[model samples]
Target: MRSLFKRCMSALACLLLALPAAAQPLPYHVDPDAREILPNLQPVPAIRFLTTADFPPFNFRDPGGELIGFNIDLARRICIEVNVACTIQAWPWDQAANALADNQGDALIAGLSMTPENGELYDFSSVYLALPGRFLTRAQAVEGFRAETLDGQKVSVRAGSAHEQFLIRYLPNIERMEFDDELEALEAVKSGSVAAFFGDAMRASFWLNDNLACCGFAGEPYFRPDLFGDGLSIAMPAGNDAVRHAIDWALVRLKQNGALDELYLRWFPVGFY
Candidate 1:
């Protein structure tokens, strides 16, 4: 019975991925969603991944002191499919890139955006996740809201983030309050101090549903990949094609077999799509 239940769930997961195809366009800046994995390549014997637990549902730990979430589960699945050993350790969020750079880890798989500049420094797999931008406001204020309606209203955005740059380019007339981080900006909205908060749709979805329920989605999710770059991909030091290809191959297998969709549904029951 348990095996049958698992099979049914897997079948439904694949259906969910296909059902949303037309309604939701793929979030990518580049054409061709995935690269073809090279044939007959050997995966490295071992891998140590560096990631952070600060982001919930994506890479945070559980109450049982177990490291679990989308990235953690996907990372383990990738290693399993490729038949390689991999370890994920929760390090300080800021240290993931450097740890991979310094060889302290083999891959960095927290929610990382893929960009050409980073491409110069690291070989990135196809995006396993793409988080679009969302606007959140008090429920009463959410109806019929548009970017133009925000003119002169206090809007909160994370300083030095893509969302902040987006407002500068598109919503220039709004009053911008730059917060040091996402929680601060969202809190401003929760307190009614700011009219709205602009942030990653995934985080905003999780936050509004779980932590701060006073706010709701203000508008459609924005998927301007030119502004946000490609979705989050795993990163390895530049020129390491073997490990890179191995992980990418695993991603392709995961998607084709529906494990990726299962993880997505598990974490994002109220997903942006």
Candidate 2:
């Protein structure tokens, strides 16, 4: 699943850093002029959103056992935009897809892969978020880091990861050190054994702020949808045009009105891009 749910660690600390405003622009954008015409104001009487409790910051349970996360808030806002009641339920990740397929839910926002295989079975909304690749370097080396000058330098990456494939394809000049996991790669950077650790930007952001004070982002986030796949999107049963149009229409408005950016900032304080 090369999605955020798979790459991200349980960094409640990153969620805690949610702030009132973001210092940078949000990653996802929608053209204000683009529009989707729905047949009626209320596309559905109510939307039953299916998600999972295991993916933190995106969808997870709060200390009070209440379902809470960026996805939860976004689903509520979507319901408001469509002028319909919203009912969200947390299901086991393995069953969420089948539940949606069986008409048990109106939408699935649990980081389902937006791949060709899934596209045949479900209709997807516009990409709401993308987990970008990034370079994490020691804090002292971040001041003037240059991707072009990384030739012959040791850069750590997780073995068999999309990020590693990206590094091999685009930046083949650098020395690659493959690790079993991102933590090992990050540790290599912290220990000065590598020039940088290349992997998911969101995870890098969390590690940078949570406890790895010795490092920081070294360059702009790398967006390679072809390699990493198109990011988080809401999925619905195939041919469900009404619901799909309603969600897409609402998403554009949310992005234009800055509501989406606000949600992004509130959830991811240390912006990955």
Candidate 3:
């Protein structure tokens, strides 16, 4: 009887030992001393970042099918500076907000726009890049293009994007076709199925310049303070103060040291402005 009691206690002890390991949350919180180290001496967590691989000049897969772009490069650099092991996991842009909210990844570093609605869903790092909305259409479709020009035209925009909201608010005359991603919108325009598409100017320019025969920038960019917000920011789960502070500090330091400018030049040799 004593032997059986000893065996039961040993089993209970083993279970107790395993419980803490399973219940422990990911170590997203940084040490106070680590912050003092600034860009260095910070222990990098082994983390995966979710991003939309289709958004180019910012984040996308190269000809070799490996992820490469400005955001991807910047994320890698940030990981290096913070001394963290990181990987970029491609996900649909529309799904990124939910993915991070669900804790599927540590953060979303895609060229995520900072809007009030999004702010309610996730915390954001400091703005890294400012982008404006632009129209994309075939060159032949460009003449006399205006908000009025969209009347009765089929327009494509990625669902859940600010451009879609802009269209619904201002250009109700146009028939808006919602897509799961900007790539799908671009494909519709390329295949001549959609009259025009709206997206970030940099993304539109990259696609138009690269896929010259199919599409081109149609008109000057449209900007509204309320709809677009300030610019693009890295997204983390709401209340992730540690990650936010780390990223904000990293951005400020990089900009101050001109590293951010060098990165911009490396990607946008002609300049985005």
Question: Highest lDDT, which number?
Answer: 2
Greater lDDT among 1 and 3 belongs to: 1
- Candidate 3 wrong stretches, greater than 4 Å: 1-47, 133-224
Record all residue pairs in model 3 with backbone atoms less than 3 Å apart, i.e. clashing.
44-84
lDDT of 2 by residue, 1-273 (tens): 334444553446245544444486577657656866654655578889999988877888766678888899999999888788889999999999999999999999989998889989999998889888989888888888888789999999999999999988889999999998778788899889999999988877666655446888887888889887778899999998888888998898788787888888888777888
Candidate 3 lDDT over 1-273, as tens digits, reads: 112222233333233223322111111122323333363324335446789866655666655677777788788777766667888898886788788899898779876667678878888876777666878887677767776777999999989888899998888889999998676788898888989998766555444434656666676667665766666678998887666666767666566556776666666532324
Q: RMSD per prediction, one decimal?
A: 8.5, 2.5, 17.1
* TM-score of candidate 1 on Cα atoms, chains taken together: 0.70
- TM per candidate comes to 0.70, 0.91, 0.55
lDDT agreement of model 3 with the native = 0.68
Q: Global lDDT of each model?
A: 0.74, 0.83, 0.68
The residue ranges of model 1 lying beyond 4 angstroms of the native Cα positions read 1-38, 41-48, 52-55, 89-105, 111-120, 141-144, 159-161, 177-184, 187-194, 211-213, 224-229
What ordering of candidates by lDDT runs from best to worst?
A: 2, 1, 3
Report the lDDT of model 2 for residue 46.
82
Error of 1 at 47 (Å): 4.3
